[model samples]
Target: MADKKWMPRWFYQLASPRWCYEITGKLLPLFVIAAILLLVTGTVWALAFAPADYQQGNSFRIIYIHVPSSILAQSCYMLMAVAGAIGLIWKMKVADMVAKCCAPIGASIAVLSLATGAIWGKPTWGSWWVWDARLTSMLILFFLYLGIIALNSAIESERTAAQSTAVLALVGLVNIPIIKYSVDWWNTLHQPATFKLTERPAMPAEMWVPLLVMVIGFYCFFAVAMMLRLRNEIIQRERRSSWVRDLIAG
Candidate 1:
């Protein structure tokens, strides 16, 4: 129905494996365009225009990419877990595809955050990694990502694998809160937040603005990557179906 098409009835209607495939394919290119534009502009602004930190000097510039990627890494797992819950509860094919698509992207972001943190750390803290609560939590998150990817692959049947991994994804989400509040709850070497909504941003506008741009850019990039992967997943899963064959033929 027109109403369904206009609204999010795709949540149910596009559960048709083929419909999900076609629609996500259409969305991929547009997300890619937005992602590239935003990412480039954000990188230039952060790297070139941002002011040097009073303490860290230019080293603090890493925060622009590191914070955004770290935030995305945590948030994306929550998203994947939520999607997994929907897939398990409603048995939706597209929901499972979304969860599948999110795993690697989230993992990659987590790794980037860790690597960048370590690079920043060697200069600031004199070590690449520490067993501090926040750092350890990030390491666990990285493994959690690996676990999800492994589960999705180890299982044989698509439906079975989806269900199994969806459950695992949900389980890992329990750690999200723990990771977030650990710095607040404990005495850690990592600084508490420099940015908050209630308070003015911690840094000068000149520095924070580029960081904000990068955050938005990372989000757009995540969306683009997830959609591209989701489209491929839907297509591969639906490959033998009549609609997919017709779509490819056309």
Candidate 2:
């Protein structure tokens, strides 16, 4: 009771791998349902209802996939770095697991972003690839994700691997701002951001509303994917423990 008074209940609970696994298991279904509903609705609305771009026509429909993937990829890298920091500072196993899980998911999202961006470029820029600032920075971001994944996998010791990856991730923090400001700072072929906090959106309601929905759905999907991977990591890491053995036995 006295120990409980010193620490937040949820924070303490997170230290327990079993608790984390069980809670994530309960939350997984809800995330899946929300992801499916939101994604399907947003996709249909964007593809069928949203008016085509005056400049790009049907090719612009790819923005629904491109923008969300790009946003999620960047966001996921930030989450991974934070998780790595937590694990490094507090030696939290769950945090390390989360950092590990983030790599593949984030990398996949980055790949999707690049693919969609290239496809969007073909019609708008008249090419499949170019070394433009935004595009180059985004490519670098993808390489950074891949580097973290490789670094983590190459190390043998779990603690050492986590620490190494944490340092690498922290260093990669410099790239995030670069990716965000590349278009504004350089003469890039890629367009400026469509959504801005300080300024009104460049797009009207009919175009941006479905995009908003898709962004939210993509975030939900990322959460679902991350939680699933974290749960699996917990099971694998804790397999020799009594609770895990009991869980398996049951």
Candidate 3:
């Protein structure tokens, strides 16, 4: 019929800033609510339900925080880059907003990962820091995130910032792959993956389940944080527009 034919598919319709922003606005609350619930449930489960590791004992509980934050840190960077790319390529304001929003969230995860790793290391690896491939690549990732964030903020024009940061994000992406593979290639001091199923992880389910929950929780946490920041960006970027005022007034 005319109505169905008139309606454009997802990509073609999302080509509009208003469409993207409006749809995202609707979803934001859902992400936030779910994130909070999951994070709380996951944290409680990880901390309370998980059993002590055979080797690390209670110290192994650190896995809940450290591993999750580390995984989130790298994933957030890729998320940011994709946001930036969509913004630059499609000229979608919402995409740029999402990218700008990701900067601080990504940086925070990286910091959390580093901090938790350091704490875990002193006890496990007998050092607070190391120059190993895994650690060093993660460090590089942190800096790369910081650099994209700085560039996005430094520019006077929003479009220019998106374009510039997109380039940086693309370039910095190399480190993500490196970080993932470093442990295998280098035979570094860092321990191998703690939780595996088919082949069995070095650790037991007692320790792994909580860690997995925490990982899922971190994803939710990051999703909520990014959406919150993106909302703020949309408001600022669209400040002079009528839609924002309506959103605010309503």
Candidate 4:
């Protein structure tokens, strides 16, 4: 009784793949609505309403998309790694599915970051590509995401694939800190962080506020995507189960 009281209801429920699928289905619409509203509002506010930068001029506007995507990409990787660890430790199928779903999403966002950075760079750096430390580390991060996806796909056994990818994801954790501090640790074309936990924002309220909104909106968008993919993953993985069969029939 004491153990039961100490344990949370939601934690036990999370062990059920069907429960996760159903709950995610119920939550999906709300996430979609929030993501759409927030992203649209933030993008419009950033592009049209925010004041132009004194140095980079209009080119700095790309930061709205680039920064958010980059931040999300790194964060998503961390989430994937953590989920992978949980799956490996607990042998949780739902957690493995979550880790699997996060890879493609993180990779896509990393690509967006690189593309936008290039677009922002052509004007600022006079070149589309650079061998700078920050750029190189980010490129490596993108490859790491792709590598996990590729490794997972190449393996035939589901459990084996999950374990292998979990190991890889754990090994990749070392790169996150390097990516975060590359600008400071080494001389690079990339500028230092615009938003720092220890310091006030380098930009004015008008600029940073929209960026904040966009960042939050991007996170919401990631959640929406991850949940959608997770639901599909649960269906695929649990297709043989009675609940899934009933869900399909009904």
TM-score of each: 0.92, 0.96, 0.88, 0.96
Report the candidate with higher TM-score, 3 versus 4: 4
How much lDDT does each candidate structure score? 0.85, 0.92, 0.79, 0.93
Error of 4 at 174 (Å): 0.3
Tens digits of per-residue lDDT for model 1, 15-127: 67767666767887787887788889878988888778888998988898889998999989998998888888777888889998898999999999999999889889999
Q: Tens-digit lDDT track for model 2 on 167-235?
A: 998899888999899899988888999788899888889999999999999999999999999989999
Q: What's the best-to-worst order under lDDT? A: 4, 2, 1, 3
lDDT of 3 by residue, 144-187 (tens): 88888788768998789889998899888889989887888897
> Per-prediction RMSD in angstroms?
3.2, 2.3, 3.9, 2.1
Lowest summed lDDT across 10 adjacent residues in model 4 is found at 1-10
Q: Model 3: runs farther than 4 Å from truth?
A: 1-8, 12-17, 195-202
Q: Please tell me which predicted candidate would have the highest lDDT against the true structure.
A: 4
lDDT, candidate 4, 1-250, per-residue tens: 2255776788668878988998898999998999999999999999899999999999999999999999999999999999999888767789899999999999999999999999999999999999999889999999999999999999999999999999999999999999999999998889999889999998999999999999999999999999989988999999999998998999
The residue pairs that clash in candidate 4, if any, are: none
| Two-way lDDT contest, 1 vs 4, winner | 4
